[model samples]
Target: MSSNKTNALSRRAFLRNSSLAGGGMIIGFNLLNSCKPKVVAEPTIDLASLDYNDFNAFIKIAENGAVTIFSPNPEIGQGVKTSMPMIIAEELDVAWKDVYVEQGILDTENYTRQVAGGSQSIRHGWDALRETGAKAKHMLVSAAAARWGVDPSECSVSEGVITNAAGETLGYGDVVNEAALLEVPEKVELKKPRDYKIMGKNAGNVDIDKITTGKPLFGLDYKTDGMVYAAVVRPPSFGHKLVSFDDSEARNMPGVIDVVTIGEKVRSLLAEDPSFSSKISSSDKVVVIAKTTWQAFKAKDAIKATWEEETPMESTEQHNKILTDLLDGSKFNTMRSDGNIKKAFAEADQVLERTYESPFLPHNCMEPMNFYANVTSEKVHLVGPIQTPAWKAGLVAKMLGREEKDILLEMTRMGGGFGRRLYGDFVIEAAEISQTINKPVKVVYTREDDMEDGIYRMAIKYRIKAGIKDGKVTAYHLKEAAVNDNMYGLIPNFFPAGAIENYQVDVASYKSNITTGAWRAPYTNFLAFAEQSFFDELAEMMEVDKIQLRLDLLDKVKPEDDERIQYSPDRMKEVIKMAVEKSGWGTKPSNVYQGFVNYYCHNTHVAEVADVEIENGSPVVKKITCVVDCGIVVNPLGAMNQIEGGVIDGVGHSMFGELAFEDGKPTANNFDRYRLIRMKEAPVVETYLMENEYSPTGLGEPTLPPAGGAVANALKAATGNRLYVQPFTKTPELLKVPEKEIIG
Candidate 1:
């Protein structure tokens, strides 16, 4: 929950007082802030006399029968711009062709859950948006009923037209002015899933044309008349602070305006705010302002700065040693325990143990980190790519000592977020530089700056032991170690947590200077690989098929006893079976080995199957099949795209993603060292969505967890070797293969 102060203007007050404009009606809805109490009763205010607030998103009907819908969440290429508005248009009973979509400004008073992380845009906004459209339809129907002197129940709406039994019809635009004057309704009936007209249908992204035509839609493309480009020369390593700088050479560079050194007060503020700690200039830095971005970059490179260095940082090998020691020791905090684990393990016939490890990964977004800000004594104006504008606004308000209303924050299309933009460090960096220079500044980050000075996905180590007897699993234990925290922070109800009879989970932490945060599916991104790969090993030891072992464990949970399990075993099994059947798991073409993996996360179930072949000693993925049960997919095409992207992203990270550190600085500063999956490496992805009536869940992340596990398991089957470490290319055995046999 947010600690920010609440707004005085309530949703009921805004809707009640909103008036008609240009003979058109505007309808607004209230999204209850999770931290605040839900508004139950409607407010008592006049509907004919007040001005509409442009900050709140709403549906507007004009005299020409055009319906304009405002989408409140940031457009981060997740298709929320089109999908969210589709929800409103479906319930509004409007034609898709008649609708025009626009992005709404950040306003916490009217919009709740504006952030795009956790894949929550569709999950949380479905009910609120549906009711908003239904309310507008109700008002329009009443207006048509009064005009025809007929009962409101006798009016039927279809495609924005209200019709009566006498065959008389009136367009929503014709009666919108009259509807604007009517009393607001407290409740309106919503359409059922079977009757949906626009939702569940394939609609192209609203900004596709602009994106394809190279129109300026991203924050990097933003430009203003007086805007100046700025770049920073930050500390080369973590655990250090800038002491002094000599910028004489930079000052003489071409197009150089001025080199400003940041003060300690702002540095302290940045350090105190966790949202800004990952920024390159968070501690201390010198900023170069110039006429163009290229000039700023060149000038920034010419600056020489002295820093107060702290203790040298440990290398990745040292960190791995720390994790190994923790696993070897008995000191750990037990998170979950069920049945008698000691008795079960002691009584078992065979006990098996294996350890899996993953490296810290960078976001590596295509656009790099950038933001635009204009700070003045009067007010602060900001525009850039941010996942949580409302939260950023609150932070800015506290930093600037200004009212939240005085600060303006706008969102622009992001090139790629993937949980990276959730932190607004870059946004605040731009604001601080603009405030110091007293000019509108666009702060730009080079690829090296963006990669080295950014928060990464925490490197994790997992050790799992299982006890088996009579070819059936008897007990299970899991221990995790990582920097700052453990894997359980994001995934407490990890797979087999409730499936096994005797289970215990423990965690140990090793603090490091490296900063970490959510990346894609967070913990599950790596946990899935460890857990699923271990399950494959277990099946081999037990002489049982992997899929059947999972099904047998799932069958242990009673259908009537709901309190024991965190996830539905039935739903988990459904996806597993779907993936197996669709991919022909038991039958494959010659020279191709198939691997299967299934897991649940983000309130969604996903199962993936990967087909791999050992082509000249290197594993090459030919195709992948993904089955997802997110419940009531709003847009099939967009959902498929999300799944396909997640699969490729997960596989790419598992195969060639690793960020190493030595002496408190990142080793892989740019793409030359940090390898990503190229176009030739991507596999043919086939996706399937389960048909169900449950409310829609998020699809952005659920498909990612299974990708790594499936690919690793497939590689094992193809090459007769297991990959316990991530970035499979790092395996010593694979490196030993002749260079001629290794595919580039």
Candidate 2:
């Protein structure tokens, strides 16, 4: 028998609500509100079974007058589970406090853009969610109007009660059944931003109760009947392969059920293939099956495995040399180009150059990586916290040699995603183990294992040069040399691309055995640091105001002139001024060294200012002030949380996060070896949201990109030294002159 304890509290909650709800196809839902005080149902839905194809998946109105809203996107601490539904609720014209929010299962047929990445959940779903809620309200009003023998134009809804022009009122619950039977409206008017009630207001996170009460909300807490536990032992180091393994001792250990050897197969399928290499460290992995997690973990330690380095092993020292060589001598791919940069540089009176470097960073999600899978001959069931559920489902089906139709996925609230959960390596691992054993299995990764076997953010070096003519900057060029892969294609269309008349972006890469992938804001995370720092240096060298230089550059670009220009100079400039005025950039105290930068990414524009204070010979980040213009705010509190979290996370990583490889093995396997920003080092983040009428953009990632640059620039202002590498903690010799400016 499996030793995993049942999550009775959560299980009971999930079952109770599942029995009360109806609907599957999500064509529409009867969104009803009653004047007779709202009845909020228990907010739990397993989403494992349903029959009503006529209703929408997002909203359910129980006959007993209970309202429940389903949030389909993965809840990865980005607060989408709470905020997304708020958009629907606002259009549904329902009381926010009386509505229950639940996580919806993967329903690719009904939901579009299901993945939670690039901070795009809201931006992509904003229209659909609004229309969904508005249509629901439209049905309710139509039903009320039919009863009153009046048109819908004569009826308006307010707080769940439908009222006629003559003040004749009817509760939405009175005609909900009639509303469901009505024809779907061709169009429904969405609420204006000025009319929003629940949107701009502060609403608590939907999972805060379960999270704060220690309920089984995360994937680690997931459990089911007759499920076995699994732990994997991957190759000792990257580029190594499994020659052979002895499981005699492992099978004999306590609670050990079986030891499955599939490492050789994994190596054949993924490790040796160049087309799909470095997604995970190219290597082998041994799956240890046991009755319990502890037993599986303990038994796995007893297995002895012989490994061989089949490929060239990578080290940090060698990687640094390779990146430097690529930057110097490699013929780079021109990602973007404008006016001739070569001629502009050749004729310039003065030129300035700088390089910034960042090490591969591990995504340290609080829950680590885990997934549960129950695989049978006919069907495969996957349940866990995954960002890309549909994509993972297809990959798992392909790997298991099963049809996509046989796969089913369910999502649980995640502890943190940070782009790590976007890959389904652990999901496939669970599926593979369960397929071999013909039973349900849950695979869990220890923190050490998660770190060692990681798809890290690529270690990259950026070299930027700007040619200056008499009193004006004439040209600019940027080159990126990364490990495994280069920056994404969209980066070429970013801010400076349009701002500089003679500009170019070139990229080159040297493949490494170490794996790499997206981390939070992707390339913009560190690119902002490099680019913004370079711009700051430009301002200093040109004897111009820092914020003014950006304003001047932004003035040079017009959104209409360039087909590739994604950022608006008008919007970008507004934010720059906002940051300067809001942060009091020009009026800070002498003790506080401030740095400001404006950035656009993930479809959101953000400006940030970092305040660094020298205390006891070391620079202490006092605070970060951010002014964000992502259009209208969905939830003020949630938006602020994202900004604060992003700034803290970005600055923290820039200050200390690093994963270095030594002969194909990472030096830091856990928090003990790796340094992160602690509370003492964290700066107070104050955000000012722009009130606008434009449609909303992304929020989760934009705030993070500008933060590193703001902090790095602030440090330079304080210490009069430029630290070009990540992990700013490596140097402690920054000037100790706290009484006055070191260089300013």
Query: RMSD in angstroms, all models?
Result: 4.8, 5.5
What is the TM-score of each predicted model, taking all chains together?
0.93, 0.92
Number of clashes recorded per candidate = 0, 2
Cα shift from native, residue 226, model 2 (Å): 0.7
Model 1 lDDT on a 0 to 1 scale: 0.81
Q: Write the per-residue lDDT of candidate 1 for residues 194-253, one digit (tens) a residue.
A: 999898888888887777878778889888779999998878887778888889999999
| Model 1 weakest lDDT span, ten residues long | 1-10
List, residue by residue over 520-581, the lDDT tens digit for candidate 2.
Answer: 99869999888899999998899998888888888988878788888888998888888888
